[model samples]
Target: MTMKKKKTIFTAVVLAVLLAACVAVDLTLPSYHIAVTVIKKATVYALVAVSMNLLNGFTGLFSLGQAGFMLLGAYAYGVLTIPVAKRASVYQYFDGGAIQFSLPEIFAGFLGDTVGSTVGMLLALLVGGLLAALMAYLIGLPVLRLKSDYLAIATLGFAEILRAFFQWNALGPITNGSNLLKSYPTFAHATPYVILAGLMIAVILLLITSTYGRAFRAIRDDEVAAEAMGINLARHKRMAFIISSFFAGIGGGMMAMYMGTIAAAPFKSTLTYEILLIVVIGGIGSITGSVLASFLYIFSSEWLLRGLDSGKFLGINSPIFKNGFRMVVLSVIIMCIVLFFRKGIMGDKELPDLLDRRSRKRKKEAAGK
Candidate 1:
């Protein structure tokens, strides 16, 4: 067999093994285990970061409206999947609630309880993504006309406006008006998350390798030239925006399931900033880098540097170790990376690309010898 084919089989086997191990851990270990929680959060963030990269990295659109799309998705999923019996209790403050139905229950009637609920949850997540894409299409019509910082500012303002709108008292009946949305269906294990994220990312990779992907990269490199080359710049840009928002929405749905609650408060501009930072740290144009950085970011922030929040580490207590110290250290590390490794950890390259390069280098050395 060819070396490339062998390598492909090896990579597939390794991934399968890792996935099996993860499922085993999820089944055997407690749900509250820190590692388990981190993996879940990382998986969600990885999806969102990759979605953001699809627009910002490939299409060269500097959008900051991810939080808005995410909020829409979270609320959509939460509102639809919440048990019908719990609606009155959840929306007690909003005149006994506006929505009196449960999507999963509707599906349960036809598909049986367990399977129906799962199918309904999947459908609800899809609805969330569709809603987000619709919003993106509406917003992108005018916003895409702007360039660079102007586009970013407009999108950021839109997110803030949407947040405020969701919190408005007039929208209370539907949105719960600043109150938390809970009692929604959620995944009990990590296997589904792994599968869903893997599938979505695989779709994204396929998109990136297609003809449209080349057009996106072309526009990213030189918009005017791409336009001159007969590419419909506006159409391609809008497509990218809508597609990115769709995935962002799905990621948000996953996050809502992971958290078991949804609130407009958490879906702020800061959330967008965090996702953008992840993309930058991961290598803006590299999906593998985003996935890798997601785990690293989650681990370091949520686990490794957790001790910095307290005054103890490695059995040593120090005055310097205090609240906010972790963020300070993380900020410094980000700054160092920006200054020294501007292209980020992967630098617009995938793991396979790196492996191929190394293999070629070794072959060249062998020939020289």
Candidate 2:
């Protein structure tokens, strides 16, 4: 078979195995299993990390406002999806909030509950993405001009400000005023989460391979050179920011669903930093690296390391291994990964690229022999 056909087969096999695994996970494992939690969280993080990578890695925009955009997405989804019947209890302080209708309810009236809820939830997620994109466009107007650390700081500050704004009592009618947004409908299994996140990540892959993606890379390489080459710097930069924020927002909506509750308290700078760390660990400019690294990071931190915190780690129950100690070990492991793989696990090249390169290398060796 030709190289392209072989690559196609390989990709299909990998995807089929993954789909089977996800289905098996939900069908076989308990809903509360660590594996389920890890799958949900990892997929969410994978999408957010890739969104951040689109800006920081592909576009060379140093922005630190991911958590803020995510907050908007989370709130947007939560505020819109809370059941009409449960609104009174959920919004106890805000007179059931401004919106009276839920998307799922409207759609469910026509379709069956299962399909309607899924469709409505998807529309809400889309709304979240659009809202984040709008915010990004507004913010990018002023801060996108700032270079490097200044841009990062500006974006970070804005994110903090947005988070605070969401918590303001005056907006409580809609935002719930520092309270948790709960009772929002969510997928009961990890399969949907995996599929949704995977689809979005696939879109990112397509974008990265598109002409605009090439423009993003050009700008990342050198703005002056790219501009000289006739790439519209301002337009492309704004597009990149908006597009990145759109996906981040979707990720945030997914995050809200995964957690079953969300408050402004958790969408902090630290959250952005964690996603950034994942991106770095995966490789700055590698999508496959980001996705793979996200799963690894979430799995190890949330599952494999849980025993360390609960005094049951490694068959060595000790007083030293207490609450939060797992984080310490995880941190050390991350440091080691960073130190050893400075270019990250995949670097800029993708898995397919690596596979092709290896194939050619082996063929050359065979020819020499």
Candidate 3:
């Protein structure tokens, strides 16, 4: 077989094995297991970070509105998917709530509980994405015209404005008005999250390899030159913005499912900053890097450096190793990376490209020998 075919087969086998392992672990292990939660959170963030990368890394759009789009998705999914029977309890604060119905429950009535509910959840996720995309399209029209820091500030302001709007009491009927939206459907295992995130990333990879993706890259490199080359900057930029927001919305839906509760407070500028930082550290334009960095960030923050918060690490009792110290260490590490390795781990290169380079190198060395 050709080396290309061998690589394809190898990649497929690896992915299959990984998926099976995730399923086994999710089924066999306890729900509260650290590995399970970390993986789930990482998976969600990976999707969001990739979406951010699509805008900032590939399209040269300095958007900081991911948190806003995510909030919209979380609220949309949570509001639509809450069990009908439980709505009264969940919305007790807002005059017994505004929305009295549930989409998934309706689906269950017609399609049977098992299949219908799953399908309904998927549809709700799609609705959430569409809502986010719609918002992006509307917002992009005006905001996409801005350049660099101006665009970033505009998007950041929009996110804050969105957060405030969600918290407004007048909109309480739809958003629960700063109150927690709970009792929504949740994923029982990491398997579903893994599958969904992988699918989304695969779709993004396909988009990045398309003609439009090349246009986006050209814009990122030189907007003036790309325009001279007959590329429509406004159209492509808006397309990337809408597409990124769509995935961000889906990621937010997955996050809501993972958390089993939703609140507007968590989806803030800070969340956007975190995801953007992940993209920067992951090699801004590389999907594989974003994913790998997501796992690493989660593991380091949630697992490895957890002991630092409690002042116990390698049995060393240092006074400085108290609460918030973990973040300090993490921040320093990120700073070091930014200063020394600005291009990040993958440096805008995909994993397949790196593998191909290595294979070529090996062949040359073998021939020389």
CA-lDDT, candidates in order: 0.91, 0.93, 0.91
lDDT string for model 3 (1-369, tens) is: 886787777678777998898888898899889989988999999999999999999998999999999998899999999988888888887775888888889899999998888988998898999999999999999999999999999999988998999999999888888899999887778888999999999999899999999999999999999999999999999999999999999999998998888999899899999898888899989998899899899889999998899989988988889999998999898888888999998988776566687888999999999
Per-candidate Cα RMSD to the true structure, in Å, reads: 1.4, 1.2, 1.4
In model 3, where do residues sit more than 4 Å from their true spots? none
Per-residue lDDT of model 1, residues 1-369, tens digit only: 787786787668767996898898798989788878888899999999999999999999999999999998898999899998998888889965788888899999999999999999998899989999999999999999999999999999999998999999888888899899998889878878888888998899899999999999999999999999999999999999999999999999999999998999999999999889889899999998899898899889999998898988778899999999988898898888778888999989976676677889999999999
- lDDT (Cα, tens digit) per residue for candidate 2, span 218-260: 9999999999999999999999999999999999999999999
Return the top candidate by TM-score: 2
Candidate order by lDDT, decreasing, is 2, 3, 1
How does residue 305 of candidate 1 score in lDDT?
A: 92
Q: How do all the candidates rank in terms of TM-score, highest first? A: 2, 1, 3
lDDT of 1 at 100: 82
| Evaluation by lDDT, superior candidate among 2 and 3 | 2
Off by over 4 Å in 1: none
Per-candidate TM-scores read 0.97, 0.97, 0.96
